[model samples]
Each structure stands twice: as C-alpha cells, then as structure tokens.
Target: MKFALNSNLRPLQMALLGSMTVVAVGFAGSAMAENRVTYKSAKAGTSYYQMGVELAQAMKEGTNGDVIVTLEESQGSVQNVMEAPSRKGNYVFTTPPSLVAAAENSKGAFEKKPDEKYKEIRALFPIPSLTMHFVTREDAGIKSFEDMAGKNILVGKGTFSANEGTKYLNLFGLDGKVNLANVELNNAVPALKNKQIDAFVTAGSFPSPNVIEAAASLPIHVLSMSDDQVKQTGAARAVIPANTYNGQTEEIVTTSLPVIAYTTTEMDDGTAYTLTKTFWEQRDKMAGNAPWWNGVTPEMLMNVSGKMHPGALKYYAEKGIEVPATAK
Candidate 1:
C-alpha cells in the first residue's frame, strides 16, 4: 500500500513512545525502592528497640540506603506481630511462639476475614529475650507453677503480655486456684509491695530498670518452668538458666520469651534476601551498639518451623535449602 506519512506526525509518535518507555522504567525503579520493610519492636529503651535501630542503620549503610527501614516502637510482640502489612511495621522483635500466639488469637490480634486469619510470620533470626519474670515477694513461698494457681497475679494488663499466663494456666486446668489481677506498669510494683498481688510475670529483653530495681529492694523470687512445661508452651517459651536474675539465685529457674528476629510477607524475596543478609553482615556493628544483637546468626533466622518470606527463602535457596511450600 503506497501511503504518504506526515513527517511531523511520525516524530511526535516516536517522541510519545519514548516518553512512555522512560516513564515505565522510572515507575519500576521507584516501586523497587519504595517497597520498604519495617522492623518493629516490643518497647523503647530496651535491647529489642536498640537492635532494631541498629538494623535500620545497617541496611542504610549496607545498601547505601537503597532499603529504607522503619523502626516502630511497639507495646509488645502481641501488638507488633499484627502490625505488619498494615503499614505499621514489617520485621518485629518477637519470641519463638508469636506466630503460634497469633494463630491461636488471630481474630484477637489481626484484621481477620473468615478466609484469611493467619499472618504466618517467619523467624528471621533469634534475638535473645529477657526473662518471663515471675517476680514475687520473698515471703509468698510460690515456688512452682502449680502454686501460682490460687494466688493473686500482677500482670501487665491491656498490653502485650496481656496476662497470657492466665490463659495457659487455665489450659493447664488451674483455673479458680489463681486469682487474676491486672494492672499497668505504674501500679505493679506498689501492688506487689503492699501484698496486693502474689506474683508478677514481667517480660523484658533489655535492662528492665524498674523490675530490676524492684528485685534488688523487695528480696523477690524468680520461678522456673519444669522441662515438660517448657516444651508445652510451643514456640513462645524457653527455659532460661538459673541465676538469670539478680538477687534471686539458687537455680531459681525461669522461662523466657524466645525473642526471635522476624519480618513480614510484605517484603519481596529479593529485598528480604538483602535484609536477611544485612542482618548477618552487620552483626558486629549491631552487637557492638546493642548487646541483644549479639545472639543473631544465620541458622537462628532459618531452620525454624514456620515458613520464611520469599525474599528470605530466595536467600536461603542459594545455600541449597529449599523453602517449604507453605513459605511460597
């Protein structure tokens, strides 16, 4: 077909197409960078908080700021774990069984649809957490978990721990034996001093200044979980060695919140790979800045029961470990 093209129209069309391609490329690059992953921690002024700040700094230094990480200080793991994908945060300072806790209480913590109830967060690395401290008056004589049944317990109420032990204790069929008393951090110490509460379970990974101060002055006791009970709490609990707490010695055993390093499904496989990489590559810098960062290792992040994120999985696949189907 013989046709005469308008030269002016041809150049305009070419220019238009070129502009569209440039826009497309720019759009893709922006998306890649803007897909930021946030890491949240239970509370501020704690080791978990310090480690998270170190991690974001490491990401900025390692990737030259290609990955902008946000650190959202949170109430506790119970709340932080649910904030991922809500634009609240991505990674979290959580314990071994946080996902288990989320799974059991999905509707309670997450924005649940009948269809999608679980966040299924992955364990990135294990951050050593503080004691699941059962601080009690020395005269209380509450030496065992069974003994906790009938006594008044001072728990951090309307917050992360949310008296989780009460549920577990009830599960153990110890209901009615333990009187439940919930209070915030402000009144907890005074209540214990006045004998208003028999024992208090405080979860802290960093230097819990108040609790530690309380321990020093009150002549308190830290209780231990038997080996069998340790296994039963699933991923959320771990047996801390005796002497973990000051002032209370003599194999006063206790279980700690497993403080696992974590990230969300929002992070893509490649980005997750970089984060998982930075988490290890900058371990020294992080640990130097914060003691809790010392505990993280490659194996601690992977080799867990839950599935890793796709980005994390992609990183692991290089080491010849295939992520399970649930992970994808």
Candidate 2:
C-alpha cells in the first residue's frame, strides 16, 4: 500500500468526487421543494377560502417559496373534495366527518357513482370545526325548522353547507313545502335583508363572517337545533356560545364538524412531509392572522376519513399523536 499517487490523477479524482457530491445535494434540495401546487377551497369569502389563503402563504414562507401553493376557489366541500383529486398536488378543505364520508362513498350529494379518486384522498391536518348557522330575521316569526314551511329559504350555493341545509329541511319534512333558494353566502345576506327570503341557512367556523355581517345590519336571530334534531339529522352536536356575535345572547345548540385538509395520495412523500411540517411550524403565525386556526390540537388531527398521507403520518408520529387505525 506504499504506492505513490499520480500527480495528475489525484486532482482529477478529487474534482470528480466533489462534483458528484454537489449534484447529489442539488437533486435532494430540488426534491424537497417541488413545483407549485393548487389548493382548492370553498368560494372566495368563505372560511375555507380564507384558510386556503393563509395556508398557501404559510407554506410559501416556511419553504422559502420552495413549495408554492396557489389558492383555488372551489364550489364547496362536496365539490372541493370531488374535484380535489382531479389533479395531483391539489388539496381541499372539508368539514365534519359526514362530508368526507359522503365523498369517499359517493353518497349523499355525491350520489352519481363511486369514484376511485375519492378513495385515494388522504388527510393532512385539521383546521377548525365548522359551526352551522341557521339565520332568520327577528321579525320573520320563524322559531324553528318547523316554522319555515312554505317560506322562501336561502341555502348555500354549490357547497356542502348547502347540502346540509337541504338535508335539514328534508329531515324536518319541509323539503317540498319550502321555497328553496340556492344562493352564495354573501348574496344570501341581501336576500334576507330585503325580505326576499324568509329564512336562510349558512355554516362555517364560529363567527361566520357572513352571519356576523348580516346580524350587524338587521335584527337577526340564529336559530338553535335541539340535540334530538341534530341526532335525527346525523349532524355532530355543536354549541354557539352566547355573545359569540353581537345580539346573540342565548347559546345556540347546533351541529358542527371538524374541517380537515386533504391531498391526493399521489403526492411524493418528501413533498407531503415538507408541506405538513411547514404548516405545523407556521400554525401560530397563520392563526394570528385567522382566529379560526386557534383550536388545532393533536387530537383534532386524528380520526379523519380516508388514509393519512405517509408523510403527514410520520410528522404526527413524531409529535406523539394517535392516528386512526383505518387511516394508518
């Protein structure tokens, strides 16, 4: 082993090895930050859309723009989940276990047929629970779902929120009797203020922006759903604490569901892991801008529909969180 190295060969070998190291590191870095991705949320001005915007910004900041997320406004939860897996790297926001269950089985609003893509959607994180808001004017004389028979009612437009409204109407046996109006959340406010509709139903995280705005302008009453009503309707029980909004004194017992972020299973593990980590790291920052993000916890991230992204699972496991067995 006492051989002398060739003067010329040593420099060449050193340069070659250095170049290989640089190339390997470059490829790994590139893989860490894939190209831009589209994040689908409910129509603009909705809580989903707001969350999408903050998520996109947080992901960008965390990755230093490596993972660029574009906010894509979608129709609603059912539509968002249905359309989410249409493209790779596209993500969606869904509330309540019901919507995800419906999308996964192609039931309820998704009753056209079974979609294989639905099975491939994976949960990423839980943002907030969507609170149902049954809006009516103080003078509408509508005390409950029973009182809305034969009156014009505004359900949400092209979102799972709207589907839930219709389900409630049907559950109360007022489906055919009431004049159902499918309109956007913002537009529904005017219809209610102008007396164009007798009652309107909308939903989002507590302090629903539209509901707050509507209540500020008119003598609005957010009707309550009894525990029995929610149980009968198959909606998760929720309570809107008194004074959550101006003029709202009494607590509103209603149904609600957690909103989860999801992505297609086809996303690379590295990208998924990076995105998930970035979201967790910047969550406090995101919540500072959007209060709806304040209540996230390890428990909230568990018990989601469909499988969990392996990347996300790895992160959760590191945090000592329990993922559902089915999802794992």
**What are the per-residue Cα lDDT tens digits for candidate 2 across 174-230?**
869998875566688888899988878877887788888888889988889877888
Q: Estimate, for each residue in 209-323, the C-alpha lDDT of model 1 and write its tens digit.
A: 5566777668777776676766666534444444444664565444455556666555455666887777667878766766545544454443354566666666666776544
Assess every candidate by TM-score: 0.65, 0.76
Displacement of the residue 73 alpha carbon in candidate 2, Å:
3.6
Clashes of each: 13, 0
Off by over 4 Å in 2: 1-35, 76-86, 89-118, 141-143, 146-152, 156-159, 173-186, 295-297
lDDT of candidate 2 at residue 71, scale 0 to 100: 82
Quantify all predictions' global Cα lDDT against the true fold: 0.63, 0.78
Tell me how far the alpha carbon of residue 285 in candidate 1 is from the true structure, in angstroms, after superposition. Answer: 4.6
Best candidate, lDDT-wise?
2
